[model samples]
Target: MTSPLYGQMMEVPLLASSLLSHASRHFGDIEIVSRRIEGDIHRYTYRDCEKRAKQLAQALIALGVEQGERIGTLAWNGYRHLECYYGVPGMGAVCHTINPRLFPDQIAFIIDHANDSYVFFDMTFWQLVENIAPLCPNVKGWIALGDEGCMAQFRADMSVPVQSYETLIGAQDGDFEWPELDERQAPILCYTSGTTGNPKGALYSHRSTVLHAYAAALPDAMSASSSDAILPVVPMFHVNAWGIPHAAPLAGAKLVLPGKDLDGKSLYDLMEAEGVTFSAGVPTVWLGLLSYMKSEGVRFSTLKRTVIGGSACPPAMLRMFEDEYGVDVIHAWGMTEMSPLGPLARLNHRQKQRPLEDQRRSLEKQGHTLFGVDMKVVGEDGRDLPWDGKSFGNLHVRGHCVIDRYFRREELPLVDGWFPTGDVATIDADGFMQITDRSKDVIKSGGEWISSIDLENIAVSHPQVAEAVCIACAHPKWTERPLIVAVLKPGATVTREELLAHFQGKVAKWWIPDDVVFATELPHTATGKLQKVRLREAYRDYVLPGAVESDA
Candidate 1:
């Protein structure tokens, strides 16, 4: 029964450690620059990172970190954080990057749920560790991510057994060899933002992580290369910083870690000082950087492309970066479930040849799926929808890097074979997929759906609007009506009538909001996405104008 159809090849397992090792040997002199927490610049080569990563592996082993045990890190995008990215998984342990912005109780819940043996944290987050120490029963000890100088403050603030990072690693030798493990073994554990309930974990395997790194570094993906210097403003805690930790070294690109200073001026300073050629982050961070540049009349020297994701990037923001400045905005979309990378918004040759207006619109859609990933939008009857561009349905993806099941959860989230993305999207004839709205956030008015994202996109295009979030308000006639909650730019004088008028003729006449409310600011989740769930609660009782007259 044996057929000769299978051509045999070398069956070497892909490991995250191999990325750093290759970079160290080939691009040893390229600097992995960091703006340290101590408010100073720290520079080291890939060779140095590889050496330190080995030492960190030894330190973890000395601490009784067994294979498959979860080791948590509550830190920023810095050098020490990067060490844990490679070192923990290098020894078959899972590196669980906990977001520091999460509520203290949620952090404790994650630590207890994951049964983390130890947590390595930055000194700036000492107080947060102190607050959660009592609740995190599984964490045996804490290690401060700084020198001996931080021990004084850590000892005073935290009652648990704690030590400095340098002191712990200083006693270890860097001669440890990375173990060869099954490529399917988990390397990193990431949790969703957990807006509704406890955050769920996505345990990424060595094979998937390594594969994602290659996809992210591809010419049409992140386009990372040896000649590029990438600044990952996106924190490592957020889906392994969108896989840059592995992708950077995998491509031999120079890395510039911006510690915790993400403000516009701080980011601008670091990019200029480091000659950062490419970067990636959420829209909220880019807005600040663009605002700073606008106000100060400054510009980027070495920066070129930036990947905008975590949330949808406004078309206005995309145009601003490409038109005003020379930076290319690589609009991207993904979920924590998909190893945080789906279709990147990088354009190809045929699409580039389209009319300028058509090209710009295509750019707004999440780019065509990368080589290894496949996507389909399905309708209510559980059949695949057409790619004619007019049909909107549930978005699902199946790929080499997509998750099979969440960590510790018995339920398999996949439908048939594809992972449901919980997003309503449409894929066009040319394979460009556009996300219309999240399944829960879409508005059904008069038995027809209105896309909140589309409305928000149009609203923000107004000159006075800085940020806008559209939510469904109760409607007496239509059952639900569209209403916009917007934040005006500083010193903005736009009125309710003026802002609402801006939306005219842009969308379906019914798609426009019935009323507009100016807000000083809007609440956001820890991941910097607009908190529509919270806004729904805040405005549940507020009557829309049409409903107000009918109710009276």
Candidate 2:
């Protein structure tokens, strides 16, 4: 063993507050715009946001709030919510962003589990706050975010004293300074959507967040810069909106947060009005936007690229965005356990010059790993698989930003040193990775694995099918085979046979779903990913027609 002398250098902790401070000092005049809950456009500058964040920190301190305490927020993507992202953490407290779409019981469970001292929520969730308040008796108080006049009724409903966000921060003079805490202190707490059991928490540190911001703002990531206007269709409450809120401010990009209105027209209007060049969100959000554009015969004047994650981006949607709208669709993959970003699609110069279809195919993959992350796929025997782009296995990753252990859980969630992502994936020789299917969701037909996402994407490519979910069903010969539950477009009709025939040449004949069931709609999670768990349960007993199919 060799003992080495450490290099003498200036040392400074990487703090979340410093990102805001940088913006305040260098890009103080850049606009941070939002469509407020009050149904009006609100505009502010980095200077104004920094001051308000300091005021919020001061107000929390005056309430006897101690460092390391948890503060909960059930708000949408807005300016005040943005303040909480910087403020609570800047004061050495953890900002716990709760997804409001969670059930009232889950909401209560999270608040109680985190031992939240106070909760700040948007007025849009007034009824949710009222219902969960009685259940979370440990919480110190409730505060509603909105105009004071719109909040009087909500204040009367809480058991604890409630105050409007304006009034609470208004009492402070923005005099507090950001505390210098350990770089390892958690600045954010986010829980996974409880699909299987009680949700688990992924606590993010000050250091990981700062590094994630730096990675996300890179040209290959979101391509955020001073010249670009970014509207994060992804909510701030979810994985810190895939790190855009922090990255945008870090790069001096103009931020346009789409509050509660994520419907197609609202997003189009906001994007056009703000001259938004880059936007990001899950595939479902972009689906709504594309549908609206095609229907209204409208086109984006300023938007250039969209980052789609949460689930695989359907090839059909990507084609529509590129062919019709001249917009680039970058597919991304990550999880709550990761600082929520892992691989993102960024083509090198040579890949960019390929034919558009060839380029689109590469972009459809989850993408290449960037700095701060590393990945490998392992088979059931726990052996590393070849990166041949054909064989797939369980995906595992480890890096600076990935979670080592979840909040409050003693069990180590890692296999060896890497975190198992619960996804079955294949990495090509070129270093691009593609998620074939979730480990639980992958369908095994005749003992051969099939990607449900591939099947579903082919199903939705049919003009008549609006949406689809591929699930493994009980079969007669093969233990479990793929079946697609499809939703048809409004006023559009297609036979079950027609939908099945659409996949003829696109995929292997055996990978084709045995049957298709048309329906009115599909189920999705709070953050808009499809709810395969509930759908699987709903079709658990479903039977295949005819005398036992043997196509596989």
Candidate 3:
């Protein structure tokens, strides 16, 4: 006979609501700062955030938003949006954060796809929601995220039920108790900003989200802590702002949410005013900040560290941050499917001991994976590639937070329990992964693979280039050739020969672009990623110079 087990531990669920409760109890005095849409700074404490969140929860329940129903939010990062993050999930309802920057069709599709019962939007998006409301029949009500008078005119104009966000929560009491919910219950939903197809939803469970927050707070990850003041420049609608919304509270850190005004001057003002220690955003956002700082001869007073992701961080930008600004730039990479927290480019002890140049090179690559995540690269034949840093293959990842299947999709996008990330990458012996290119965007020239990302990074490093992209232009002999499209800084000029000469000794001669094109501004996605697809389409029919074959 088997012996019985000893004492049983508590069976508490890892719901997101618990994070808020812990923050309120342990770090109630911590500040939650925001630059409101009305162009003013709004400040509150964690205790206030928790009380308001509970009141919002009561309001949600009173509005007949049942368990498992979807509550969509079309707003920027701010105190009210943070309340929605907790209140919607705390009440057992799924919080669907709609990206307002997405195309109108995509926004409408996502609203209908999620069957959102109520949409809480800010005054900035009033006209957008007004125009798209008729298309989203499933959306039961519209709540403007403002004071009672802010929405009065809109409410009077609209025939549907339009209410004020502040009034709704103010009418409810904060005495409501959170119900016991399963850890695996879906709490948040985010859609991918995929380049090719329509956006797909990645529904995150309460357990996955909470675990991601913990992993993101680790020293090697985002290194978030109570002593740190975080400024998340990344929009809240983008992958839960890379999980900062939860990770900040989980670590009891002070949060500074930048709403709407993402300009360099505005961000600089907030960082200096709030004494922000850490910030996170895409490369474009940082580029603007760095430019503004340089042109104005401004210096960072309190900003010390930044997390650059959404696209590869250029070596020039990384060096500028580290060498000139004395700030640590953590190069991170992840996807909406993986709950958006994966490898962070922080050096271990051994890596730190390496030569400065070697360490910088490693930092140039995407850093090692977090504790809970597993990564691998596979060839076309389903064989695992060696981690020698030379062999590149399809990148695949799996973990507690990775998605097994997309929401409402019948087919599972997995292979042997791993989700293919649709990226071509190489992993070194140290387990550092470097994304070479997207599988679709890779230029195949004379049966040899040229990484468009590598070329673009190299080209953008040029002193005169503000932005650059490499696309495959059709060729007669090689079937395809790389063409560099560059956007020069204001009043900056460079000849194609000079730009081509810059690639000398940096990369193979064949890898260099045969010709260069200049543009005033390059296109970018809603999340700030370069839109190469449009460039490819625009140059699809252009023939290579001195080509032997002509169009038949």
Q: Which ranges in model 2 have alpha carbons more than 4 Å from their true place?
A: 1-4, 156-160, 547-552
Please write out the lDDT profile of model 2 over residues 149-190, one tens digit for every residue.
987766676555677889889999997788899999999999
Model 1 lDDT tens row, 1-552: 545996677767999899999999999999999988888999999999999999999998998889999999999999999999999999999999999999999999999889999999998898898889989877888999999885785577567778889999999989988998999899999999999899999999999999999999998889999999999999999999999989999989999999999999999998998899999999999999999999999998889999999889999999999999988999899889888888877667888888988989988888788766899999989899999888999999999888888889999999999999999999998888999999999999989999999999999999789999999988877888888999999999999999888988998888879889989899999999999999999999878876867655
Give Cα distance to truth, residue 492, candidate 3, Å. 0.9
Residue 203 lDDT (model 1): 93
Please give, for residues 1-552, the per-residue lDDT of candidate 3 as tens digits.
Answer: 433775566889999999999999999999999989777889999999999999999999999999999999999999999999999999999999999998988999999999999999988988888789989998889998899766765666666667889999999989978788999999999999857788999999999999999999999999999999999999999999999999999999999999999999999988999999999999999989999999999999888899999999999899999999999999999999999978989998999999999999999998899977899999989999999999999999999999999999999999999999999999999999999999989999999899998999899899999899999998877888999999998888789989999999999998988889898888899899999899999999876665555443
Runs in model 1 lying further than 4 Å from the true structure: 1-8, 550-552
TM-score of 2: 0.97
lDDT for residue 184 in candidate 1, whole number 0-100: 88
| CA lDDT of every candidate | 0.91, 0.90, 0.92
Which has the higher lDDT value, candidate number 1 or candidate number 2? 1
Please state every model's RMSD to the true fold in angstroms.
1.5, 2.0, 1.7
